[model samples]
Target: MFGDDWLWMAVQWSPPYGERAGFDTSTTVMLLVTALVKAAFLWLILRAPLPGPLDRRARALRRLLYLAVAYALVLWYPIGLLPDAVDTASQLALWAAIDVLYLLVIRWRSRVLRAAAAALFAVELAGVADQLLDDLNLRQVHWGEVVGLGWMVGGAAATVLTVVGQWRDGRWSRGTLVAGWASLGVYALVITLNLLAGHLFSGGPAVSVIMDAAGLVTTVWLAATARELPTENSVPDLPPARLRAIRVAVATVTVLPIIAMIHPEQAARLTYTGWSTDCYDRPSFGDLKPAQRDAVFLCVARGMDGGGPPMFPESMSDQAILAYGRALCRAKDRDEQEAILTRAGSARPSWGVNPWDLVYVCPEIIGATHPELLRSAEETQAANDAYIAEENAKCRDPWPRTKGVVQATAKYFLFVDGDPGYLVHDPGDQAAEEEADKLYSGDGLVTVGRNSALVGHIEDVSDLCLTVKAFRTAPPRRTAGWQQVEEVPIVSRTGRLTVPEMGEDEVGAGAPMPNLAIKGKGRYRLRVYVRIDDGGEEQHLVVVFPGASRKKLTLKP
Candidate 1:
């Protein structure tokens, strides 16, 4: 009976190491109190007067010993001894047995039984004391009360039994019994107070006062009601085999549950990965549906160099209007593009166009011809540029366009147009207004119109024009205003050039302007200056050149 099964149960019932109370002063005091209580109870039982029969007393002593052993088992194994279900059942059984045993002792009317019960009660008191200490030290009051309360109740019952046994045996006078009863009452009060303090303060030094009072009262009551010693005699003993069997049964019933609680579960040891395609770990365009995928692909394709291929085949039916829009842009078939975009806008009324789509590719078509449709796009770009300028100005830095040659380089990058009208206009006959609305409504077409003139110019020349502007910096000497200094220009001759005619009206005061009429196929440079009066300060110049490419010059005083 005492086998691996019992050991497993014990292992299961043992308290988890993580939950164990750390050793501390409060724990030590609890242990000390428990030891003192046990010693006092033992002294009382040993000194108690002999009852009518030695056998009755022996039986009582045996019962108390059993209870003491049970308390020890509980303390050693706490919760981990068995499976959760089994441990719960075992706990119920143990409590039931204690109650039944108490009832039997009361019915037997034996002083010896009472003494034995008291001894067992003392053991339970010790167990509870240790539990209380653990709770105080570990700050686990909830668990402590759960495990320790039972033991405290058992101890109180045992104390009362001892007092009754002494009184019935005629070992004490009536006055002494009354006093003992009164002492028991005081002990109960003290225990109640200890419980209250424990609940109120939880794990604190304040509880020690109550525990001390309870312990003192219990000790004094036990001492005052001490019984005379009974003579020792030989009694019938169980066979060795029977004794072994009983021991095995007791261990199996009591120790197995605690052992079972400590082992880790099998499920905790395994890990899972990539259970399904929707799982994040599995990877693939998991979030996009087929339509959304096609939408994104077609949108990106329409915005590619020269408005490239259709992202999806012509045969695909769902969201066909978007596919039609892509075909229009791809074919550079303006009538078809307009027709498709219009259809898309009608189908999806919530769609809004984006003007930035036309800002670069078809700026003239969208901005100049259909200004209302693309105004927001232009304003957005201008706002973005202003924000960047404001941030750069914070460091006392001049705008890059006002510096030497940088603006020309920047414009060269910005205005490089290989196939300008490629994405500007739809190839279909749909109205520009409808197409623009669809684009804005997120029908996937970038609605900004392309400049036919700009695209023609780029194609004709095959080269980009660079316009350079120059400005003078502030002088070292104190002055009211700045004056313009000499201007220098640098040219990048790599592409073809076709300078547009510039009118005199475009020139501003003291601005070194470009004379487009004198233009040649190769890059050229020109210098201009601003005149200042009284030499008040070094003048700063502003220059504007006609073309997509413009550079700036900074003149230091």
Candidate 2:
């Protein structure tokens, strides 16, 4: 089960619908191009002329040729889309099919070896068949799990015999090497090597394409260096008509897999996956009706295997929900938008996303809890600008602008900005509060004083902010802003951002935040706005340096 889960995790290299990591259209296009080249190369190898008629190996070569041809065509664009639910089962079937092919080429002389190979073949075939039916709503795929032990036992036995039998024959035949190399390709494709290698390689469609390239190259080797087998003393036979008939048989089956292309069945519509999300490039969800919108999104989400890791921090769940919510918010109007966001509240475990735009859908929640969003976007921006001006006048420092991956229908980039008081000097007070709300107390960011440890890994850094809890007093008023003082500057870059090297002593000297990595030696100062829960607002400027006075604020867990 962990193998399945890890393979699923390893294969998620594609960015969400709209990501800001500069992973753009060109990279995706190149991925598609690689797959096509692999498919074409495989087709060429599969269609290579069979061993000469005088060769006793011709029968086996012809069968392998036919099988490989069918497999390549199906494994390409159209037919390979079976087991079509677009989940783990579908992925398993694709990889399992390759295993079946590897088992096929093992020359079993003993009855025991043949039986083991046959058993492995039968179980995998049944598993793959049940998967297709499972997607069609005809049956569940429980039997595959039940038979998997027998499947592995049979597979291992076949592999051992194949190797030992080849060793007994003195030299390794080119055919045997080709089959072994292709089997290794199958192993590499399904993550057998990656798991042992500790996930050093990246995944997604590109990895699968690499495996197919291996298969094509191995097939070429198989054909060019085919082993010389026993032949009859009689002259080479097979008349012109018979040779033409064999060619026709190969060509006919080669083209038969195209039926899936002509009538791809429901998998084309039902199975939306990472490989095919942009295949048709459907218009915005706002362009569809209620029923159509849900249908499209559900299919696409299933395809992409959306949902949180089984046991993960709340931040992971929140991001998955945010990405999906951003996609769903593309509704035609306020009425449709309400239908989508309202699910977060009604759904069993709440989505836990901030009610930033929920004002349009659930204003009651905001009016009672998140009063910050009561203001409009323009009002929030103006307030941020005014505060930035004050800081500039007093400290002669420009407010730092942080960027984020913006969705196509996003109103503005700060979907949920963390506290501007953290590493990022974000000017927006409301955005800062919402972003901080997710991280301030979560495993992602928990700050302590100079004597304590840091929270979160380097992955916590985003374009807009590095979510962190500063070892300073919680702002008394509705808003506050913080930045490294002129002396102990936190970063090394001027315009572009870069992580600074933090030594043990320096880290213990200033802020207790994990990502601070303070760069300078001398002390520093920062301005803040604060108000008591029951009283009027006030302003204060605090200094920071080695052995500076630090206050640890309690954050919500």
Candidate 3:
């Protein structure tokens, strides 16, 4: 039904899958040949004359053939994974009820039985009507769907009403005959829809038209025989035993497909011989066997020409690409490594992502061997260093003045670092024990590492004007805030620092302010001068300069 999907499936065992854009010449030829065969069968069904005036037995046999055709065409929906199968239980109940009612009316010609069957048919028609309403609106109705729906409603109504009339009146009327002809309209409607909708057939136009022709033939037979009621001792038919056997055969045909549906994997295991050779043109490629997946990876790593989209393109899952990359990482040969990396680079479709970034799956190897390719990180660090050098060069012996003052709560802290974390004040605060172990100290200000320090304030300090000034040498310090000074040694990774406000809990809770840019990445001496006014306002000066070795030193107020 799914065109090149099934056609190409024949050769899907070939390496790589889902890469085909259109049908090849051979597939096209095969489709045409298949279409011709289907057309021939359709022609035979629709135009081939009946052998003679078919008796009741002959008509019944022909109707069985029609049933077989229907089972072949439709049973796939339920037997496969179509959502329509969810209604199986209710549909089977309806069918059983209608079938029993039909048999009862046939045997005893009960008016009640006829009415019940008519009611069941009406219920079926109601379902069709509901579907019709759901499918199209008044202003945007597509006649194709409507006609397709009519085909179903018309057929069921014709069959049931004809049987009901037979039970009640013992003869067919013009109305029942017209109803039978209307049932034939299903074939017309479906074919028309296919054309009207620009040949949007479920299994392509060829397959759909054949099915429609087959349906039309079935409707023609049923309509032609609707009035041919049997008399006593009509031409000898199959015995009871044979009739039972036929019913069993039909039931087996119906049930086997359902059994497959219930355990499709078992069916696939039994039927599927194996996959095709190494070529990626299959419908689905996700669940590949380990060996097959490895082979594909090896093929791509060897730089084998895929001739179309690269194997394991960027569109694939990172996990899949990573799996391949990890396998490539296992290769120790330098040439092989380069070949794999080159292939990985080409497969990356997105821009701004370094080719080396594609194999971040093996970051340790790539980072160690090809650090230069990690330019994004390097470029960012360089830019930050340049900005810091420029800003730090503005520092002088007399600190440059600042403009605006920021307000803060009485007891807040300034944490200076490229990346700062919350402070752990209490040694008993076990929840933050790990952070305290790595970074806490007893002093008001303590340098955690080469790059970070925590500076605390206990008194209420508002109007906090903050500024940073840097010098090539340690410039003489001048008192600023409360004549309290704390000096700490810090190392700069990218020559940049930030001071963020810490809350009363000693946790860094406010935004970092007044970033400090110094000379290039290296060890530096940092001095903080604090001045507090009697009216609860403060001013601070920070000075940074080159230094070799230093320790934390604090002067209290």
Best prediction by lDDT: 3
Q: Could you tell me which 10 consecutive residues in candidate 3 have the lowest summed lDDT? A: 265-274
**1-557: candidate 2 lDDT, tens digit per residue:** 44323332332322233223432353354444444545444554554443335333345544554454444434344443444665445445544554454344434456666566556656555655665666778756575554766655544454455455443433344344435444544543444433422223222333443444444544443432233221222224357687567557534433332221232232123222223233245433333333343334333333222454221122223334434456344445555554554544323223323344333333444446666555655666667556534532432111223211210100011112342223332212344334434444644333322222223322212112222222222222222343211111221122111122223322211112222213332221222222211222111222222223234333222
Compared with the true structure, model 3 gives a TM-score of 0.29
Error of 3 at 136 (Å): 9.0
Error of 3 at 489 (Å): 27
Give the per-residue lDDT digits (tens) of candidate 1, residues 1-557. Answer: 45433322333333223333343554344444444444443444344443544456445544544444344334435554544544444444554454344444333366577567756655564564454445445443454665566766666666566567655555444433543555556556566555444223335332442343333333343333322223342223457787677457534432332232222332111111112222222122224343333333333323223444333233333335343433443434445555555554432222323333322233344455555433344564566456444532332212342454322211111223332211122222134324433433221111222210111111222222233342232222222233333323223232212222222322111112232212322233323232332522112222322233233333423
lDDT of 3 by residue, 241-294 (tens): 866775575344333322322322312211211233243432112334433443
The global C-alpha lDDT for each of the candidates, from Candidate 1 onward, is: 0.37, 0.37, 0.45
Output the lDDT of residue 513, model 3. 41
TM-scores vs. true structure, each candidate: 0.21, 0.28, 0.29
Q: What shift in Å separates residue 332 of candidate 1 from its native position after superposition?
A: 92
Please count the clashing residue pairs in each candidate, in the order shown.
Answer: 78, 7, 21
| Candidate 3 wrong stretches, greater than 4 Å | 1-120, 127-557
